[model samples]
Target: MTHDPRTALLSAALDAAARGWHVFPLRPGTKRPALHGADRCRTTGDCAGGHLKWQERATVDPHRITLCWQTSPANIGLATGPSGLVVVDLDVPKNQDNSNSSADTPDGATTFKALCERTGHPVPTTHRVRTASGGHHLYFTAPAGIRLGNTAGTLAPLVDTRAWGGYVVAAGSLTPGGSYETVHDTAPAPLPGWLLELLQPAPARPVVPLRLPAVNGSRAALAALEAECAVVAAAPEKQGNITLNRCTFKVGRFVAWGDLPRHVAENAFQAAGEARGLTAAECRSTIRSALDSSLRKVRPRETA
Candidate 1:
């Protein structure tokens, strides 16, 4: 006897729910509904097949359904639990030359492996979804109790289990290739220890907001310099310099440094740093430190 895909999917979801797993459908292109109950469908159109009912039934133990997906109803689902799932969106860098590639590079798989090792987690089941940009969504789940959104702006690697496809292995939820997965069964792995600490399931300490110093000429100069420093601090492989230069140019225009003398440019840079929260003295000191270290290494072998 042939099994219906919809029935099969619902049964799987219900089974998972029985085992304390939260179930959500993973149909793409369906409108998300406003209903809060698990028995109600959260989408409409071809992707809406029996999802509402599944959700309503699952809601009986809302925290038990891990996730659910329907291909005919257009690929969608729901996530219910104490800690939502973690999703890593991967994209290919524009600068990288991938003209001759057909599958995820070695580096990509290696990165995924490293993340799995770091998180002490195993790769759960995987899925391929039709994405908005005509790309494929590769899904993986981590163990329970893992936090998702806490690593929103982090870069992580992904493994392409598909026979043909590639992905970006950088930080953060926004990837050039596609958006990050919104739900999963387990917490994302290889989560940085610091991030894990921040995402502890307890109420977090209130962060003290720092007050910026008054925006004076000096403060503006300092702010500019601080901005430049931030650019210099980024990874060289990540176009840090270009980004920094763009920010510097924008500051130069804002502070009217374009019409000023060369010395004024320096002052404006310093003032910008101060305006952005760094002290003028600190900005100067950091620049001097970088220069001093560079000079020490390059200066002809000190003539004793």
Candidate 2:
């Protein structure tokens, strides 16, 4: 079978460990190896002599040596698949100000630290450089029974440690914009213990019933209403400009006036009413009155 470079690299590292060798795993972007104490490999198959020696020294605990790949680098090219390794994507935003004076801490680094604290795991001292994008890759040794999986959308598996990827630590997950700060390998502030405790567990809330209005009793009226709604719902996209009412109308699955663009859909109802010999203004006013009545029914009354 043709050799997969990533798999080959991992297999060699594992084999070296089995033979009482200490292996240090590294990634492409950064000068520092993700697994410290080992130097970069010059080629796909070649390991620096120092790294080989370190691997030999680590042979007593073969699990010490691990390969970590960056799966969620902003630039797609350098992202890698999980090879039974523990990959932690530190999704830092590009606009993040790394300067210490800034009031806001880097969301990604803060989140990473939080995860480590919560899990009672020591954070790795080293990080991998991502291609072009400012995100850093951190790899941690996985707790037993977790193996990394394949890439899905923007997410990729880190090494073989499945437990590590796809978790959203509020701090580490990137915002709508790309920017984050590095909390690893620096004199960062301690993560709040209270936040970690709150994350531990919480009670579930009771579910509330959702009530929707019954459709008009007349089949002909219901069909006409449905057709009118369909036309109004398609209007925004058809016109190539979005209005608040159009947006609301589009999101509503049911033909409830409350769910629709009140004024726009009301106008359509008025037009329909006029065509059917009812006064346009009266039809519109009726809908407004119904909406007001429904709103009052749903809301809690003020207590004296």
Candidate 3:
């Protein structure tokens, strides 16, 4: 007998809810959240008080899961924080260039293994999910009395963690690339003490105002560059790289117009990002890539 796709998806959602995971619906065949974002809120239904983000709205209720999936074949989204989980997302390299054009360039799993070895710890066996992109998500129970946030490239290259404000596609969910499947069907183990030490958030630091070097640029351009640099310098910990990328991209039009020299902006933002505790390498890569993308898409000066 041919199985109904909606039934299968509903089953996936219910199964996740059964595990005490706060579950939500992902867009069918995609990883993106299916719920309307804050901008689309109409102050109705779930938004009666205010707009609730997907993470806040995620529920472990089987009835809600069934109702949601009964309407469409939506994929399953698991809110790691509400579920008391910290998922280490080990991603694969995107292309040959990112892989350093070397056959030996380690993927996320390999790098994580090396990290484990260096720390003199065995790889923790826990609930594991294989992503559609040929990557792995190692699930661990979060330590009590401690709240952790998401991280990017903090553990290692291609290693990211999903915690508060982040979610992961649960096992049995389907994406265009393939299905997210359970590889290790076991209860998630408590986070390893050593790994917890590595993931523990640093004490909050006060953000200092940035001082920019004078550069040859239009007055407006200079002001804009300085403003964006301050935003980078004051970015919250664990969020510096994204803030730097966004702020740098916003200022890239000045470089394209020759009002701000590319190197001047690059150097200034690099310093600001580093001051915010981002690694030098992470800042450099994010700045260059954002600038390149912005520069390519910028309209001609005369058009502006």
Q: Which candidate number has the best lDDT?
A: 3
- TM-score quality measure for candidate 2: 0.24
Model 2 bad stretches (over 4 Å): 1-82, 97-105, 118-121, 141-304
CA lDDT scores, all candidates in order:
0.36, 0.34, 0.85
lDDT tens digits by residue: candidate 1, 198-219: 2233332233332324333555
Measured with C-alpha atoms, the lDDT of residue 154 in candidate 2 is 13
Q: Put down candidate 2 lDDT per residue, 1-304, tens digits, no spaces.
A: 8744444344444543453323343333222233333444452333434344222232223343332312211111111222223334555444456564544434455544544554456655643333234545553333334233322111111111112223211112222344223344332222234322221222332333222235433454345455744443333321211122232233232234243444544555444333333333333433443334334434332330
Q: Candidate 2: lDDT of 64?
A: 39
Q: Candidate 1 at 117: error in angstroms?
A: 8.2
Error of 3 at 246 (Å): 21
TM for candidate 3 is 0.68
Between prediction 2 and prediction 3, the one with superior lDDT is 3
Q: Please identify model 1 stretches exceeding 4 Å from their true place.
A: 1-3, 26-76, 80-109, 112-150, 153-195, 198-227, 231-304
Clash totals, every prediction: 63, 24, 0
Ranking by lDDT: 3, 1, 2
RMSD each, Å: 13.3, 18.6, 9.4
TM-scores across all candidates? 0.33, 0.24, 0.68
Residue 8 Cα positional deviation in candidate 1, in Å, after optimal superposition: 1.8
